[model samples]
Target: MNVEGRTIEEDAVSAPPPDLSEWALHAFCLGARSSPHPVVAMDDNGRILYYAVGGIDMDRLMELGLKPNESQLALMKAYRLLTVEDGRLTTSFPVVGPQVMGELRRDIRAISADVTQSIRRDSEEMCAELARRGHAHHGYAVVFGHAVDGLVWEQLRDQLPSTKLSLERPFWNGAFWAIHPRRDDAAGVNEHPWSEGTLVSVWSARIAFELRSFLTESAVGRLTHNADGVLPVIHSDDSDELHRHGKLIAERLAEAILCDPRSKALSERIVGTHPGESLLIFAHELIWDLMDCLVEATPLVRPRALDNGSAPASDLRQLLFIRQ
Candidate 1:
C-alpha cells in the first residue's frame, strides 16, 4: 500500500488541507491591521456573541469572570471583523468563538424578552444596596432614568462626529433589556460572567474595587445633572469591568430611565431610536468580530464607502476607512 508514501486511490488519500491556523492568524492579523475594532475570528467551536447594548445606551462592559491582577484591559474583548484590500486590513467589532458566540446570541435573545421584568428585579435589589450605603449615585444620559438610548445612525454620527463603528449605534450591555435574547435560543453562558450594554460607559466604569468608575462617571448627579442632545461615550481600559459588580446595576439604571420624569422630555432628541434596526447593526458588528478572530484568509480586500458590488461585499466593508 502507498499509505506510508501518501499515495492512494484518486480520492482515497485526500489528506486534509494543511493546518491553516498559523498562516490564517498571520494573514488575519495583517488584514485586520487597518482597523482597530475588535473582531470574532472563525472557529469550528460554534462560538456565539450576544449583543446587549447599542446606540447611545451606556457602555459595553463584559466581565470575563474577574481576575485579581487585572487592569481594565484584562476584561475587554478582542474580537473583530477583518478585511484585506489593496494590501491593507480593516476591522469591525471584537471576535469570539462559534460556541461562545452562539451561546451569547441565544442568551441575549432570551434575556431581551423579559428585560422589563428583569430590570424591575434588579432595580429592587440595587435600591436596597444603595440604601445600605446611605446615599445613591446617578448617571448623565438620564432619559427619565432609562440611562441610555441609541440615536439613529445619522443622529449619532451628528452627535459624535469623531467616532467610527462598522454598524449603526453598536452598543450592548447585560443591563440592556432591549437586546437580551428572549427565546430559549441561547446555547450557553460563559463562566467568565458576561455583561451587556454599550462598550463606551462600561469600559471605563470600574476604577477601584470598593469604588468603581460607573458609580462615579456614568451616574447622573440627579438634580445636579442636565445635558441634552449629546451623549458621552469615552473609551478606556476600564470598560471591560463595568459589569463585574453584577447585572443588577444595569437593570436598576434601565428601569429608572424608563420611569423618570426629566428623561420623558426627550421627544425630539434622538429622532428615531427604534428596536429592530439598531439590533441588527449590533449583531452584525458583534458577529463579524467573532469571525475576525476565528478565520484567516486573505482575498484581495479593498476599502470603500457603502456596500457595493464594486469589489465584493466583504472587501468593500473592510476597506471603508471613511464612509459618507
Candidate 2:
C-alpha cells in the first residue's frame, strides 16, 4: 500500500483487498516464487467464464496510476500482464463483465486451493522432472489453457530456463465446463456450447531473479483446439520435438515474408520504410514461431487495457538481425 504516495509495505500482510475499486498492477510472474499466477477461465466461444480473482480490482488499480512493480505481489486474477512478486500475482483482461457475483465466489474458493496445489505440483513432479533431464526451470500456472499439468509443463520449463508459465480456469456460477474443470465457459456461450472454438491462452514469462527482487515479463498468445473445448494434451515425449518445430515455424515465416503478395506493403506500414524492413517482417513473424514452439499460446490479443492503457513494448529494435 502507498501512503502519502509513498510505499508503506510495512503492513502488507495486514493489507486487505483495497476497499477502493482501483488497483496497481505489476509485471509478469516469472518463476521466482511459489504461488499461482492468476488464471482466467474461458469457454468454447472465447469469452471469459469469470475473473478467478477479478480483473475489475485491477482496473481500479490502474485508475490510480501505479505502474507494475516487479517487487510487489498484491494483485488480482488476471493475465493482462503475467508477473508475481512479494507473494502476489497479477494477470489482466478487459472490463467485459456483468461477471456473475456467485461465479466470483466459487472462483475464490477454487483459485485459492489451486494456487497452493499448483505450487506443490511444481516443486514435486515438475521440478524433479527437470533435474532428471539435466534441465533447470520450474513453471507456475496461467489464466489460460487446460488444467495446469505438472509433467506437461516440464518441457517449457526446460526450454525457457528462466521462465514461469500459468494455466487458467474459472468456475461458473452454477455450471461446469463440459470439456474440463480448468477451462470455463465463454461470455455468451453456455458452458456446454457445441462447435465453438475450444482454445486457451498461453502466457510465457522470462525472469531475471535479483537478490531481493525478480524481473518478470512475457508475451501472451493462443492455442486453439477442438470443438469440445478440450485443449489437445501434449505430453513429455512431444516436448523436444515441439521446440524444434518452432524453429521450423521460424524458417517458414521468413519465406512467407518474401513470398506473401502483400508482404511488401505490410512491411512498409509497420517499419515506416520498405527495402530495409524485410528483416523486421521476418522478425515479427518469427515472434509467431516463438509462439508456436511454446507448449501453448493465446490465439488473440485484447485490443487495449480496460483503462485504455498500453503495455510497454519490449525493445525489439535489436531483434532485427538479418540472416547472412
Candidate 3:
C-alpha cells in the first residue's frame, strides 16, 4: 500500500518497472469504463462473479481520434490518461486483503466535496432526462458502504435546500431514498439506489456513485466465501509484462499532463480553469478511492448471495419462508 511511486522526473529519464500494485488499483477503478470486454472479479470456484459498470464506451470513442467533438475529445483524453487497460488484469495478487486496507481507508476518508458535486451533476442530469420522458417523475440513489447511513443524506439535504429527501428505508446499513428538486412535483419513494455517500465520508460522492452503479446494475456475481478475491486472468502469459508497459505509459501521460505546458494547456481547455489543478487532483484521488472500495468489497460473500434467484426459485423462496 505504501509502495514508492515513480517520480514525475524519473519518468523523463527512463521508464521504470510496472508497479503491479498501482496497476491493479487502476484496473480495479476504471476497467469497466475503459475496456472493450468485461472486467470481472473471480470467485474461489474460478467463476467470474462481479462485473464493473461503465457509463461511456471508451474504446469506441478512442477510435474516433480527432473526429470527435471538443467535449468528447476532453473526456477521451481524461479516460486515456487516468485508466489502465480495459480487459486485462494488472496485478499478480487479489486486490482484497486486510494488509492493504489501512492505506485504502485513509485514502477513502480524504475524498472532497467538489468531487461529490461533480458526481451529483451527472446523476441529476440522468434524473432530469428520465423525467422528460415521463418514465419516472424522479429517481434517487445513494452511493454508500455498509458503515454509512441516512445521516449523510440528511446533512446533504440540509445543505442543498433545492432538493427534498425522503427515506424509503429506515435501516442504517443500506438506506434507500427518493430525492428531487424542491420545486419539482415528483412524488413517492420506490425501489432504487440513486443515493450517494461514502464510509466516514472518506470517498468522494462521484466515485461512490460510480461504484454503486457497477454493483447494482451490472451482471450479479458472487464472491467466494473462503477465497481472497481473485482478479480475472485475461492472459495466462505476458499479462505481467503488458501491465508493466501499460503502467509506464499511463504514468508518463499523467506526468505529461502536469509537466508539459502544451499538455497542461490542453487539460485546462478540456477540464476548465476554475478549480483547475485541484479538480484534476480530485479526479485522481477519486479513482484511487474507487479502486480501494472495489477491492475491499469484492471478497465479501454475503452481498453475492442476495441476487433474486431464477423465476422458479424466486417463488419457492417466498413459499418456503412464508406460511400459507
Candidate 4:
C-alpha cells in the first residue's frame, strides 16, 4: 500500500508539460507570483482557480486554515473548466473567473476609500490649524504637500474662512500647513524644491523654544539687541558647543522640511546651496559662520548672501541665521 501511495504522489508531481502553449504556462506563473499570502487565483465568477502548492509544507497550508484535501479541493474548484492537454492539465487558463475578480477589485477599492478618508482628515486638521494661526497673526497661510495631497488641500482651502493661500510671500507671518499622506511620495520630493516657496515664512510653534535653547546653551551672554529684540547673534570661535548648537538647529530645520512633505526637494536645494555629504554638519557650519557675521557686526545687518560659498537669502537665512 505504501509503495502504491508513493507511486500515486510521484505521478501527481510533474513539471507543467511542454505541449501547453507558452502563454498558458506564463499566465499561471504570473498568477503564482502576484497573488496574496497563500496565492490562490480565483476566476471572475468567484470559482477557485489554480494554485502552485508543490513544495508548500502541510503545516503552512494548515496555517491558512487548509488541510491537504481542502487545498486540493480548492485548486480543483478554481480549475473546474480545465481540459487535459497532452496528458497534463492546461495552466494557461486564468485562475480567477470574472465573478471573483470583481469581488477582489471591490475589496481593494474599499480599502483605498478608507485610507483616503483618513488622509483627508489629517490634511483638514493641518489646514484648520494654519487658518487659525493666520487669523491670530493677521497673516495668510501657505499650504503644501505631496502633489496629490496639495491638490486635495487646495480644493479644501477655499472653505477656510479669512484664509488666503499663496505660493509667494505676502509679507505676513505665513502659517505653514503640510498635508501628510499615508504613504511617502518619494518621486514628488525629488521633483519639487522648498526654496521655490517662502520657506522663511514657515512658522512653527517650536521655533521659539529651539531658538532660546540654542542661545542659552551656545551663545550665553553673546545675545545682542536687534530689530527682533534681544536674540542670539553671530558665531564665536569654533567649539564643541557651537558645533552642537549648529547640529541641533540643522536637525530641527531638517525636521521642518521633512515634515513639510517637500523634504527631498528641499534637500536637493540645500545640496545646491552647500554641497556636501553630511547636511547636518553643513547646516551647522553654515549657521555658525552666518551668525558670526551677524552678531560681530557693530550695527545689525540683514545678510542678503553669504561671504562664503553659500546660496543667497532664504527663509532659513532670515529666520534662524539672522536675528529678526
TM-score of each: 0.19, 0.20, 0.21, 0.16
TM-score for predicted model 2 compared with the true structure: 0.20
Per-residue CA lDDT of model 3 for 1-324, tens digit only, reads: 111232323443342222221121221121122321112211110111101111224343334231234453333223322122553211211222222333433443434222333334333443344345432211221122110111222222222212122242111111111111111111111112222211111122223333334334331232111023221111112243322322332333333334445433333332212333322332333333432342243221112112222223222111110000
Q: After superposition, how far is residue 243 of candidate 3 from its true place, in Å?
A: 30
Candidate 3, residue 277: how far the Cα is off, in Å: 25
**Candidate 1 residues 1-324, lDDT tens each?**
121122223352343112112111211111122322222223311111222111111122123222222221222232222222342222223222222334454444333334434333333333344335332221211111121122112222322223233343233211111111121211110011113223222110111121222223343232113233123221212232212112343434334334443323321122223332233323332222222221122111112211222333222212111000
What is the C-alpha lDDT profile of model 4 across 232-272, one tens digit per residue?
A: 22222234232223333333333432343332333343221
Estimate the lDDT of model 4: 0.26
RMSD of 4: 24.8
Give the Cα lDDT of each candidate: 0.24, 0.26, 0.25, 0.26
> RMSD to the native, candidate 2?
22.1
- Selected candidate, larger TM-score, 1 vs 4: 1
Error in Å for residue 165 of model 3? 46
Q: Any runs in candidate 2 off by more than 4 Å, and if so which?
A: 1-212, 215-240, 270-274, 278-324
Error of 2 at 257 (Å): 1.7
